[model samples]
Target chain A: MGEEKGNVKWQMNQKCATIGFHANPGSKAVKTRVSLFVTCIVDQVFPQVGIAMTQVLERLGYPVDFPAAQTCCGQPAFNSGYPEEAGIVARHFLNTFRDSEYIVVPSGSCASMIVHHYTDIFANEQKTLEQARSIAPRVWEFSRFLIEVAGVEDVGASFDGVVTYHDSCHSLREMHIKEGPRRLLSKVQGLTLREMEPAEECCGFGGTFSVKFPEVSGGMARTKIESILKTEAGTVVSVDSSCLMQIQGAIDRARLPIRTMHLAEVLAGR
Target chain B: MTGQPSETINQTLGDARLQLAIYSATNRLMTHRAGAVRADLLPDYQELRTEANQLKKHTIEHLDHYLELFEKNVIAHGGKVVYCSDSQEVADFVLGLAKERGAHLIVKSKSMTTEEIHFNERLEKHGLEAVETDLGEYILQLAHQRPYHIVAPALHLTRYDVAEIFSKNLGVENEVVIEKQTKIARAALREKFLHADIGVTGANFLVADSGAVVVVENEGNARLTTSAPKIHITVAGIEKLIPRAQDLGVFLTLLGRSATGQPLTVYTSFLSGPRRNGEIDGPDEFYVVLLDNGRTKLLADPEKRQSLYCIRCGACLNHCPVYRKIGGHNYPWVYSGPIGAIITPQFHGVLKDPWLPFASSLCGACAEVCPVKIEIPKLLLKLRSEVTDAQRRQGVGGVERLAFGIWAWVMTHPRIYLMLARIGGIFLPLLPKVGPLGKWASQREVPKLAKTSFHQWWKAREVPK
Candidate 1:
């Protein structure tokens, strides 16, 4: 009973809405402004996805701004168990996006940092810890925010392809933005959405993990591509660009002719 | 990849390539799992995970009460429930029952719990033939190899491999086609299933309230394996027990979806006990052996207890990056993947497979996929600590201890660490082009050092105007 109370107390102190975790405004009224956190990977590798994300948010009447100097979410270090290094990176992130009302990211992995890691990231510094807790409630994945928060199902975009979506690990499992993406995808006109097999599994593209555990990553990618092939879809779509890139890398390696795209890209009607 | 450690088992699975092949297959399955979670599930999926976790926790906490109720119900329904404290006892009880019944042939289904006990070897010692009815198990039986993956047992074997095995073993000369291979195994196992006096199977969940054991499978082999035999013996870990039948809804919902990413398995068979008077096809005698086998010890430790919540869904195994590369044979146990890293140490004792826990990249993907929400990485770390503690007590080997002791000293002293890092930055790269160190750096590129260390850079940055 005491333990349960302690947990509840800790939870209550951490002022965050667990509902629609990847959503932006959610069902609750927002007094503060909101900005989009275009993740490092998207900023670097697929800038178009970032632009699509902004366009989508703009379409939803969201005043989305890219917080410059937001390098990475520090997940690379955090997941690697280098707490000290992760702290350094996290402190950098917090300082960069210190003024945002809500920090929404295109990637689930980055969103999870705000939701899951920030509290632990600022465990020592009391003031920063409060900021982390406050910031966590507003951290949203792009699709999650659109579907759950803005109540926008169709982005008024058109894409014609039998596109299948890959669920990134942190997004689907940690953030639980499963239905939000599909719900939005379901609204897209001229899109013949064929479901792929074994969809909830990881693509084995865990940031540094892909390089470090290359064989496992490759194997996971191969399987993902095989399933995509089974679906007979010309294009494989996923919310996380990292998963798409991983499967795409394998698809290229295997010399298979399947194209991979981000959810933003698909939703943006390309 | 590191070579397999020298141990009791000779030729630590001459199936590394085979395992690689199988892991490739599992990866495909994992991608499907990814798609399933992404496309089909709601954004509130974490809520489901929390609910599933709560359900499992609630079920585990009141397990004794449930077990008692389950046992009573099983007996009420004409099933004999045997709770064995250890694997050997469970084997003994089963062997004794088989002897009493004069059972000479036993057909088996895919059960990791039964595999854990080496029940086939035990039965074989008594001159009883145990035939695996599952297609994958049959393939492994022919190959003389253990299961590499949980969900797909002979997942390592290609259709060509299976065809070759069938041709050699069954005197058929057909080029390996998946259809032909599956048909052959189906035909071959069907004969064994009919003639077998008893059937041994694994339970997906042992419902405490109903005293029922449920088996979920894609292939219809389990159906035949259980009902065809006169006597049916269900072997399962004690942790498979859940509070009630109603709770099975959540588990069944998650199990197939999480495992193979299937909406539902083809067969979800629920067997309460022996056949009733009016029943047409069912076992005459039903035996549920609840094997504790070090799980009680695990259950006692709050930190490690979540290992018990695992439903053997194989989601962790399928998604594990390390398991993909190294495969199951490296673990030195029947169970492999993230669950294996935690449970193998507990069941086989932490002293064995000291390297198993470190096999993980700490990705937390396993915990993500776990239907019951077992925090496998944490348990792996706990087991690693246990292994370290055990090694410290046992007084580790001379060279290993010496190396670690030096490492420990270097780690504690920042001065020594900096000095070594500096020296390493300078001369380590210079001396690495020749000799033993060259061999170490052969396939690997050492990271290029900055002109100044991070500490040095930090100090310079702090020197503000």
Candidate 2:
């Protein structure tokens, strides 16, 4: 059992470094190390996003680490009004990445949950609240980390297509990530970045809101799709996969030929 | 009335005509409001909002003092102040006044507070005629329906619907044209206004220092409703007081611009008391009924008293995406949209309809557009927690609690988290499309799970040279 557990940890480290994350082979020296918090949705549904994020960061000369103990940021429970359950998962998350210098998440919603809401979840416990506050400032969403922290606008990426970006509500409203994704997308060669009408409005995924109020959710998705179609962009890109899922779901149902892609995937290039 | 918000929403969603009506009306209002608040009309809109918020905060905090001052000032200004603890008391007071004055007909302008008290229904039950003189309210009164939108009571009705209601109720024909319909309603309500024995109206703002009941409107109906009658009864909630008359400048500037994108409403009447001794065409007796039906309950909660800061601009409603989709009738209240979502649960309790708070997408649009900057999304979340706590106390939400409990446990353990994902990937496609999953899949296709998760793919891949 011990050997198996050790092997799993080793494999996770190997996985972290698979996408050219190491600057020098077997060399422990690097400018920075980032712990990847591949939010649960991207981890399971759109793993390419995680891969694309890793590749982009690795290319930026940062050694990335995927802590095997990291599971989720507990946004699902937190947003669903189960703060106690959210606290349990949040404390575990805080413990897992407690020692990391920089923690990066590919999802704006999850990143925001950690940065903005973790303190509220751990409000009853003073030590945990301080821990959350300390962890809060260090946590950055993928594109934001790329632009603000790493100070890289262009990642040597190229994608040939007309694309529009949806401002995920959490990212736009909570994290103020309006221009980061667009700035990066603008630098990509051969990519025509079209602006969709009401681009800042929500796609209405809203976590469990899609299932809880399916009709309203579906209605909002249709409204967003109509806005996307108006842009005449072949692909709809957003930083949050949860939003992309809702948009893609509506597009598929409508049988529209429009495609959805994560910002990381677009930046990682074809 | 309770626990049927979803049912009402579903019914409204099914009616495409009503949906279109609500969508276009609110869209127009939102666009107009946005244009009205631009630098040209109000360059320092944000500053004004902040000051307005501060004034409201101060007033609400010392609400008892301000209310007493307002009552004293009103009484000193020759107006009678009657304090009502509930809707019944308000109706009783109004009926008693009407009986003492030997009044039969009452003309009212748009007042959401009156709608809240069901004043018209109560008056009718007591054999008194209460006519809604505002065109939208007039149409709704004829149709026997509540106001659909806060600002636009007949917003859910199309010109055709109004024409139909007129033809059926008023024996008017060929008034399909919008202008002609307005003419028909104006002609019908003109006599009612002249013959009105008592004009009942709702106060938009009560100036405590000067004893002024400020009424803002466009149709001039409120002006007529307050004047042109022997007895003018102004029913207002105590939360509407501002400390001084000058405060109206900040509020008035924001109110019309946020409400309908107009720089100033056409008629802004300040009725301090009954007409002065020499004044012509003003009521002889003025009574201000201060209703505190569940308002003090909210005022007592320090965290939530900011809800009282609402100026009833309806800007949040116009800009709200959910309100645009589901419309006002789904809320089933005199006040609807984001403000309704917060206030309804607070006043009526979460058990009334546990879903009202969750009905919103929490997009924060409401907060962004709120003239007074009520943190609506936060309040919604707070109310949601209250609802969850209530559910917990009643031994409800067991299944959801269990699911979240298991989810929390799994998410804390990475090994189990990944294992469950892998298993779900293999079996989610095979699981029958039923229950909550089915509901999600019904309208939109569920995303297909990746064959190899990023971790698995990364772990098995060769390192770059």
Pick by TM-score: which candidate is best? 2
lDDT tens digits by residue: candidate 1, A1-270? 422434764344234433333223333233224576776556545666777776777655666555544556666545543444556666666777777766778888788877887786577889878877877777778887776566678788888878888877778767887788887888888887788876776676665445534445555566677778889988887788777767776776667778887888778874
Question: Where does candidate 1 stray beyond 4 Å?
Answer: A1-270, B1-20, B39-44, B397-424, B431-442, B453-464
Residue runs of model 2 more than 4 Å from their true location after superposition? A1-30, B1-7, B39-41, B461-465
**Candidate 1's iRMSD:** 9.7
The weakest ten consecutive residues by lDDT in model 1 chain A span: A22-31
Model 1 per-residue lDDT tens digits across residues B44-67: 556667777887787677778878
TM-score of chain B of each: 0.89, 0.97
